[model samples]
Target: MADLNSLLDDLAAESAELEALVAPLPPEQWARPTPAAGWTIAHQIGHLTWTDEVATLAATDARTGSTDFTELLTEAAPRIATFVDDAAALAAGAPVPELLQRWQDGRAVLAEALRAVPADAKVAWFGPPMRPGSMATARLMETWAHGQDVADALGIRREPTDRLRAVAHIGVRTRDFAYAVRELPPPADEFRVELTAPSGAQWSWGPADAAQRISGSALDFCLLVTQRRHPDDLALQATGKQAMEWLTIAQAFAGPPGTGREAGVFS
Candidate 1:
């Protein structure tokens, strides 16, 4: 497991990488549509900015022993399904320069806020409470996922990096939450997940001899869980019945199951 400081550093690096890709875009390109049907590059950056703001608020509240985040969640519960999209849409309306600066500032604030959280504290979030390290990992996952949208919009291909280790770890850890959101029961047995990282190192989880297994490139697994690509378009392999089913509905991020990309759309 990564310590909070290490995870925060990687989170910043991931954000910086994506920022480099977007920082130079001309105004017209910000309106380019991404793989997400109605969202453009602006929407992608807007979503990240909005999320970082919320995460910063949550972390700060946790640090101060305030109930602000809990109350915010309660207020949002009624609109949970539409709120994420609504927030993204609203943020996307800002001028490109303003949106970009907000994302830059918000993420920096979130990192600082997270670092100040007590080691034993659990911060409130959309899902379960998280330790500061886990919160940083979640932030890293969202940044990378949205970064893919921005990359796709610009027709730019990002090099996969070891930072993906954090994203894949979240993908595997959220297996049960994926099932729950679908109102389906998770499999009774643990499934083995093995992926070859970009550097060709093996990253494995669960019992080595588990009956159900998923194996492939770690990049593909991260893309699958983030719903950035259709499973049929990836190089993943699944053994056993439940494991195969999991490939179809896997989602690493919180919120409703996404309207996943159609197979061959990006093929």
Candidate 2:
């Protein structure tokens, strides 16, 4: 488990970075096509803001053992879908600066809620109870991944930071999340992952004696696992069938499988 203070700090920082990135875009650019087909920058940010709000409600409901979270989201999804559709429709007419400010404000509230949760406390996620630390990490990963789409569309490249460690951890731990989504049992043996961190330092996971090994730069590994970038685009080298298989379906999220942005969509 990650230290609560560190996780909170990372989430705060990631949220700020996302806000900064979106702040300067022109109104017309908000509705411009991104790498993710059928989504614009406004749509992407709206999704993040909506999910954060939902996660907070789910966490609150977990403490009370109330079904309010589930019921509310069930009823809210359609409304959110409509909002997303309407957001796209209004993007061209909306003031980009004001909309960006709204996104920043939404993220600030979400960050505050995440910081208030105890690290070890299990909160109701999409279907399972997840540690607050894990949830915070997931939020970072999603923000960074979606931010990548916006950055790509705008032809900007934000350098990776040590904060990316949180994102990488989620990517690695969710190996089981992926398996469960496929209704398969997680592999019993742990595979060794030796990744070069963005700061030029090396990070390793699992036992040294493990037969399977995944070696690559942290940025590439993060992008691959997040489905933000394809494995072929990176220099990741995986040895053994299980290691290779894991990469085939590395979903760090609980929802339905994302179609993933089309290949070379950014390039």
Candidate 3:
């Protein structure tokens, strides 16, 4: 298993990057629409805050927490759109400043809670119960994805950091999840996933010469999985039919298959 403490640091760094981005913005930007239809930057942060609070609960108390998540999972199975809509609508009601404060506070508590969990322990989540390292990574992935939306809404390009390598790793690790969520079985043959992280370092999964492969900059892979960038607009290349299909439906985070970013929206 990966190091939970390091993963926690990565989560904090990713979260703070978004806070820094949003903190300096004019009040008007908070209400501006993000790439997520009908959701403003405020909603982005607010949703993150809400999820962080729940994740903390799941981390510290997975027994009862998992039961609650199962109920939510059951109810949201057929109508995930309604679940998402309701969550965001409720989150959007809070004022932006307060939401940001809540996010910071929530994450602080989450960091502590995660570190206190036994390394072998699993925690409840929207998709699956995960161990400490994975739980922290999931939080990191969500913060980065929503931060992308905030960056898009502000018309700013955030410089990629080494911290983003964590998100890229999650995207690669979730290849089967991308298919599973769509009710498609994973391909029979494994595919190599090779990415150049933001630090300009190489990262990989599967065999080096799997014949079936996807290769690209880490940023593109992360954007694709987060549904923050359309494949048509990214520099990614796929060699296998399964790899190609996976790219089209990649979603690293737990959610209903997201309607990926509209082509040319972020171009």
Q: Please provide TM-scores, in order, for all candidate models, with all chains considered together.
A: 0.97, 0.87, 0.92
Error of 3 at 99 (Å): 1.5
lDDT of each: 0.92, 0.75, 0.83
lDDT of 2 by residue, 149-178 (tens): 888877889989988888888888888878
Per-residue error for 115 in candidate 2, Å, reads 3.3
The global Cα lDDT (0 to 1) of model 3 is 0.83
Q: Quick one: best TM-score, which candidate?
A: 1
Q: On a 0 to 1 TM-score scale, where does candidate 3 land against the true structure?
A: 0.92
Candidate 2's C-alpha runs over 4 A off are: 63-66, 76-98, 262-267
Query: How many residue pairs clash in all the candidates, one count each?
Result: 0, 0, 0
Query: In candidate 2, where is summed lDDT lowest over 10 consecutive residues?
Result: 83-92
TM-score of 2: 0.87
Cα lDDT tens digits for candidate 1, 1-267: 689899999999999999999889897888899888788888888998998888888898889988888888899889988788889999999999999999999988998999999999998999888889999999999999999988887788899998999999999999999999999999999999999999989999999999999999999999999999999999999999999999999999888777788899778
Cα error, residue 201 of model 1, in Å, equals 0.9
Consecutive 10-residue window with the lowest summed lDDT within model 1: 253-262
